[model samples]
Target: MSEKVTVLVAGSWGTALASVLADNGLQVTVWARSEEQVAEMNQQHTNTKYLPDAVLSTQITATSDLAAAMDGTKAVVIVAPSKAMRQVCSDLKPYYHPDMLCIHATKGFETKTLKRMSTVISEELGCLESDVVVLSGPSHAEEVVKRLPTTVVVASHNAKAAAAAQSLFMNEDYFRVYTNLDLVGVELAGALKNIIALGAGMVDGLGFGDNAKAALLTRGLAEMVRVGSEMGANPLTFSGLAGIGDLMVTASSQHSRNWRAGYMLGQGKSLDEVMASMNMVVEGIRTTEAARDISLKYNVQMPIAEQLYHVLFEQSDPRTAVETLMGRNPKNEMEVMKLETWQQWHS
Candidate 1:
């Protein structure tokens, strides 16, 4: 099985996952947009620009050619940023096999359609929902590549697809991949958590104490459940790996680019300024917009998401948005539980 699997990853996260699979004795190929990174990974066995200090397996092959990298792959893990996903998939569509399992690790929604990464894969590859799987959780690329203790979840409506994806990444030493049946909840939790992580980063950057960060995380989870539940997702999924797990890692970890973007915003940098300087993708910026639209479409109130959206696009002051969140209408904890009213929860 190890010798049969091939992977398609474009960035550090993809490269890291490929390396992990390679370490597990699977044949992995990483597709990099830059020839330099590909050459470095192929010749030196290191992706110094992205995963510096982490050595890749000799079995792992890196290439700049997308079709060549994707050739004969059993599973293709689309790991590029959300904005680039469409174009990448478009280029590979002509070569995609119907039987190939399309997996995505990108934790973001498309800016134009607010579509999840899996949706983009399905649309581009002309595959059914069952043919797509999403693998996401608290695992960060930098840490996972270092063999750090990390857990992640693979979700798909098709149980067999989920199980196959789980087998691809699960390892006793480094990555412990779990399986879930709630594709909507898992993908939503993974994508929306980045917005909360950005807010958390802003709170910390403003020199706020843990109390403030804690409040943000808690409220953020409530908002996530609200939006996700309205979209026919299992609310309990928010408490699991792809939800709370992702939130914890993205909001607090230094490796998180979205958190860093918010932190810079708190420190008085403009959105454009921060975006221009950061080389990595701050998924929250785009997710914030999509979340704002989602909140309105579902008639859900996501104050935190709204505030972040204003700060990000509407040019509202971050400090002012924080004040707004702090002084919102007071309500009991059960106020959030009401959001699940649209659909009855038997459990």
Candidate 2:
């Protein structure tokens, strides 16, 4: 018998990941909050609101009942949106067992606590924080559902847990999974990059040229590394698949909700209007607020995120935010890069 895995929620990313596990010959059950959505997935094998164009795998199943979804599953993959993670995990506590391999593909922080998704999951499930593997990278759900050669990383402090996650998702032809031990870095990089992606989209919406977008991506990455390192992440992870690679894809892709939200804001739509127009949750909007709080908590300088916070919440004009970024006190480009040089010379 094929191993059973249950994926929480039937959003685009969740549904897409469930398909990957199904393709790997696992009996995958996807839990959705809506009975109507569950009916559609089982009857038509389609989640039209999310993954509209792609047909789902036959090995995949759907249920609105959480307990039914958890029944006999060997692994539980939590892919609920960040805002809903705590409630979802709390609800799953009755069904979650210690022996089950726990993994999360969610990529944003808890707004209330500024906690990572893995932390939230671990607390709700009463499991070790290090035992929760985070799955993230440049892999977009739309592309992944089409089997377009997506690659992602699974990070956990426990090497065994990371390898277990890797084995469950890896496919030679189109889907690939790599393991990394830098759980903090991977989680931080994944969440923080969405903020930069939002800024990237704003640049495009403002009719800015490629040079502007390039600068945003580069500098945005510096901000990510700075905040991530302060939060105990490995600085090198910022240069890897979960960091720069994910940033590139999210900033450039049409599939990103955060980018779309930022683009609309740049085009002069109100935050309320942009959010109302979006059917999906734009993680970066909330994440920007969380990053702002994090910056203040850690005393890290995150000018872009700070500017975005004002633009998003304080009603600051997007153009003025850009100006503020440009007019900041000039600094050397190699400040972050030449740390080793400075240390060696001093030694």
Candidate 3:
């Protein structure tokens, strides 16, 4: 009866979630790549580099040894960045077993293969893609570590896996977890919204009024639903927490790395300078590229994402990108939403 829970990587989100599990009275182990981070988490009971304000629970420990961290754990939470996901999962492959419930909080796609995080994890773990659960929403690690009220979703094609994830992270007071069977929808919503958040930040950085941001969010959601539905995701999921809810928070908050990075970009900084200053992975940079490819593959119209790709990669001016988007031929909003019907939700 191995009930041990382990969180791979000691990043902000991973440490924050480890805190939740530790608070729940579960013995949690956080695996770190740096021995110094591991020693800091174990000795100082603080992860000052990532989470400076809070002290970690004694129930949680960390290790640099991959095998030692993963040994005999029934539940494993992988929170590596998208760029490191495959390699991290590959590193975990030998220690992986069929019985482990692999729940991943990593958002964004593997741009190289244009595969979802679940697809990457399942391939490395030799498990069904449905066996990997995706945890996402507007939850920021900074607030989540402070025990602030936050809600998120855990989606999997496997009901029991989703249920187990719901049970593992749901906090009665501060953190709320919802279960969704639409794995595709949850992943896409979580990944795609970052691109919109980047645009929202650029709007703010450009000193555009709320009117512009509101329009961006509204239309951004439409684009999210448009691409998601094309990829076999339910349109209604966009209306829920993973979609609009996550979009609002990411777009508005300074705590969001993507938004902050975009703000720098809008302030006339080069992409390299923005990346160098953030000292963190701004997921939108990579996601914008991945989403562009996804849209082209699906043959869907994603004007916003398209412009963002150019602005980010092609060195197109931010103002010019906005103008390009504004100049596009108009189509009726509803006419574009070819879902079964938007009327069903209102009925």
- Candidate 3 accuracy as TM-score: 0.96
On the 0 to 100 scale, the lDDT of residue 283 in model 1 is: 84
TM-score of each candidate? 0.96, 0.97, 0.96
C-alpha lDDT values of all predictions: 0.86, 0.92, 0.90
* Highest-scoring model, lDDT: 2
Query: Which 10 successive residues of model 3 have the least lDDT summed?
Result: 337-346
Give the runs in model 2 whose Cα sits over 4 Å from its true position. Answer: 337-347
Query: Per-prediction RMSD in angstroms?
Result: 1.6, 2.2, 1.9
For residues 277-329, what per-residue lDDT tens digits would candidate 3 score against the true structure?
A: 88678888999999999988988888999998998998989989888888889
Ranking by TM-score: 2, 3, 1
User: In candidate 2, what are the lDDT values of residues 1-347, reduced to their tens digit?
Assistant: 99999999899999999999998999999999899999999999999999899899989999989999999999999999999999999999999999999999988999979999999999999999989999999988999999999989999999999999999999998999999999999999999999999999999899887999999999999999888877878788888999999999999988888889889988999999998999998899889999999999988889999999999999999999999999999998755533643354346
Which segments of candidate 3 are over 4 A away from where they belong? 339-347
| Candidate 3: clashing pairs of residues | none
Candidate 3 lDDT score at position 181: 96
